[model samples]
Target: MRVWISGGGGFVGSNIVRAAVDGGHDVLTTAHTFVPPPDAAYAVSKVDMTNGADVRASIDSFDPDLVVHCAIMNDWDRMYADRQASWNAYVNATRHTAQAAIEGVDASYVLVSTDWVFDGTQGGADELTPPNPINLYGTLKLASEMVALEAGGAVARVSGVNGQHLARPSTPRAQDRGFGYFVASIVDSLSANEPFTVWEADDINMVATPSLALECGEIMLAIGEKHGTGVFHCCGADAVTRRDLAELTCDVFDLDADLLDFGPPDPASMLAAPVPYDTSLTTPRTDRILGRTATPVRTLIERFREQYAAQVGEPS
Candidate 1:
């Protein structure tokens, strides 16, 4: 199967590209600003999702069997301030891509979504979880999902996505980037003999990149191939708190857990939307369809250590 991905050079899309390529499928990836991943046997093109004409042109030219749309502008900080970033990143871009898919592209589409749509009232939620977004980021993403549904697109709503790529020095991540990066920060702080703080109040059922891609690829391929699989949830092994997550990484990387500061999440420092206290998703329908549970957090963190350590030239 031939696949095309937006945000192909990013954290998740790159993993999807690698997995697809390794599985003996043809892939075409695109990046808006970042230099596209080095030209591999599979093609990586430059695409600007902000421009509908360009997105349409790229889809028409690729003519892929599957297209995974992962280009989201998730500036969560600006979401509640009436900022247009989310609208531009999700709403407009998705509507444009939906038109391209239904009228121009030949591939089946997968729209990656988020767990934030639930407003943190429930845990172990599934695709049937009613969406009541408390912030613009989730709200716009929900709009984007609705837009893509016009084309019968497959939806993969994700919560936390961890694991980092080889540090190109170009891809700088922040503490709030994802849980894995936060773990990385804790490691770095310890390495530097500095102190770091962590929130101890939530549980996570997050999906890392490759596992997410596989489940997404499987379901969307089914959807695109006329198998009639509708919406699905792509989640991880089990839920863990930030405190436990920190301790796990520390033990794995052999860092001093003593330097860590665990406390309740500082409300004032938190983002506008309430983070899910228990953000766990159960996708039995997804599992029945895909035939497997997504990867466990323990194994994922070990892989992260290996990958990140290698990037830092440390013997793993």
Candidate 2:
């Protein structure tokens, strides 16, 4: 199958590009600013997703059998700092991409969404649960979801995705830029003998089902291959809190747990957006559809450790 992926230079999209090439599919990908290293297995192009004409032209030129829209403005700090840019990246980009996919080529479309679409009053939300986003990021993501679905496309809602930086692997600490960068940041701090703090929402810690970017990418490909529609929960099976995730990272990387400190969530921190306290998701429908269970947290962390070690030229 000929597959085209948006945001190919991003954490999750880069993994999807590798997975598509590994799966023997003809792949075309787009990046806005950060151009990925050239690879013989697939093609990469610079396309402004927020521009309708650019998006349409790229899709029409590729004429892909499937188009997976993974581009999103998910930086919590940036979302609050500039709402208009976030809207353009999320809502506008999604609208243009979905239109190009459906109207230009009639290609099967799968949108990469997030579990933040749900309110934190409850966790383990399934596909049937109605979304009630609490922050601007989630609201915009929900809007993007609606756009894709209204255009007769599928939505793959993933959570806490992390992996090695495929686009700029040579850059020092490049893994600290995208979703799930906290894990790498923690490792970096502890390795440097510096103290690290994990924040909590009052007495309760924020929880999420973290998944590896590569695994999420494979699941997305499965959705596109099956021509899936509606929502699919593509996340880790284990719902862990912020502290638990930190402890797990320390364990996997054999770092010092004594350096870890606890604190309340601070708005002055890089995470300025109002995050849901517990946005963990369950993947029963995704499991049934893909014929596989979501990965466990420890297992995912172990894989991340290996990838990080390889990126840093350390023994895993």
Candidate 3:
């Protein structure tokens, strides 16, 4: 089967490419400008996701049996400060992907969503849980989920994504930081002997790259081949608090506990009320239907350490 994946250069997209190829599927992927593996099985193309013409042309040209909408304007912290750009990236990109898929050979679309879509209020949320996104980024993702679902696509309301992040650094600007740029920040803080803190009380879900992509790849193939589409989740069984995650990492690396910090989440940070104190997903339906489950947080973090050790050329 021919599969078209947007955001092919991203952590999730690249891993999906490998999974799809391993599954004997001909995969075609795209990057923002030029960001893909040098010798990737999937033919990589640069796409302006916000531009409908470009997105449409790419989909039409690929003529895929399935479409994976993994690319979105996900500027994590910046979205809270600048929502207009977020709208263009998330909402506009969704519009383009939907319109393009509608014109395809009845492509099965799978959109990647986030746990942030929930207003951090619900506990043990199910697939039917209506999204109460707290931030503009999550709000747009919810909107995009509706867009993809309306196009008769399956929406994967994913949780936190974690893995060794890789990208060709722009230039010889500064020292080479570690993988998982976000986690790297923590490592850097530890190296500087500075304090790094996170909300201790908030629950968070984390998924590794290979695990998340493998689940998505399998689901896309099944949905496309079987003509089954709906909402599914990609998250681990055991969820960890933000504070616990930092502490776990510190323990794994045998770093100083003083280098990490934790506290209650700022209630005012999100727009949704009754914030989902435990945004964990009961993925029984997902596991039963898809025959897949995401990796545990420990394994996910372990992989990161392996990759980190490799890049640093030293043992963790």
Candidate 4:
């Protein structure tokens, strides 16, 4: 299969690129600013998603059998600070991709979505759950998903994705970037015996990046193969509080649990957005269609530890 991915240099899309390559598919990837390190295995191109002509030209040129749209302007702080840029990245870019899929080729299109599309009132939200996004990012993603559906595409909504990647820098940032980065940074800090904080009230069902990518790739491939489109939720089987996740990371890494402090989440934090308290997703559709089961949190954390060790050249 010929597969093309947008934002393939990013944290999530990079994982999808690796997964697709491992699955023996011909892969093409696009990067806006951060060009991924060159790999002989897949083709890379620079694409500005905000430009309809750029997106259309790229997709039309690739003419892929499957196109997984994972691009986004995902920095929470920047999304709020520069709302127009965020809109262009998420809403306008998605519209361009959808049009390319609809007008250009018979490619199976898959739009990566988030559990943030929900408003947090319903825990374990399913494919049938209506999206009521509470924040600008979520709202734009939902709108993108609508564009995808109109273009005869499927939406794969995933939870917080965590795993180590070669693209991630060794130094920890002052603010949390995303769940995966947050977990890795916490482990790195705890390993250095540095104090770290976790919110007791914040909750999410975190999925391993490779897991989400594998399932999402297979689901997207199946969608292309069958010429079908709909929504699929691929998330962890269980939800955990930030506190519990931190404690579990400590346990898995044999770090000092004493250095971890628990606290309430501050909405004013740099990582702040309209995060749902409990956006755990149920994946009956994924199970029925892809024969996938929800991965356990412990299992995912263990995978994370192994990957981290590999990336850092340390013992697991």
Best by lDDT: 2
Query: Which is the winner by lDDT between candidate 3 and candidate 4?
Result: 4
Candidate with more favorable, higher lDDT: 1 or 4 = 4
Can you rank all candidates by TM-score, best first? 2, 4, 1, 3
Per-residue lDDT of candidate 2, residues 1-316 (tens digit): 8999998887778888888998999999997887655544788778988788898988999999899999877567787889898999998898898888877898889999988788777688999799998778789999999999999999999887777767666534422212366687788788889888777654232777888888888898998888888899888889988788889998989998999998764444534445576788898888898888888899998988888777774422
User: Tens-digit lDDT track for model 1 on 203-301?
Assistant: 322322222333344445544455333567765666666677778778878777888886655455466454545556667777677666666767766
Query: Candidate 1: what lDDT?
Result: 0.65
Model 3: per-residue Cα lDDT over 176-222, one tens digit each: 11112335455556766777755444333222222233444555566
Error of 2 at 244 (Å): 1.2
Runs of candidate 2 with Cα error greater than 4 angstroms are 74-85, 170-179, 203-205, 265-267, 270-273
Q: Quote each prediction's TM-score.
A: 0.83, 0.90, 0.76, 0.87
Question: What clash pairs does model 4 have?
Answer: none
Better of 2 and 3 by TM-score: 2
Supply candidate 3's per-residue lDDT for 52: 84
Local distance difference test, per candidate? 0.65, 0.81, 0.64, 0.72
Model 2 weakest lDDT span, ten residues long: 170-179
Q: Please write out the lDDT profile of model 4 over residues 95-166, one tens digit for every residue.
A: 888778766877888888888888777777888889898778779899888888887888888676666543
Q: Candidate 3: which pairs clash?
A: 120-275, 120-276, 121-275, 121-276, 122-276
> Whose lDDT is higher: candidate 2's or candidate 4's?
2
What lDDT score goes with residue 246 in model 1?
77
Q: How close is candidate 1 to the true structure, as a TM-score?
A: 0.83
What is residue 205's positional error in candidate 1, in angstroms? 12
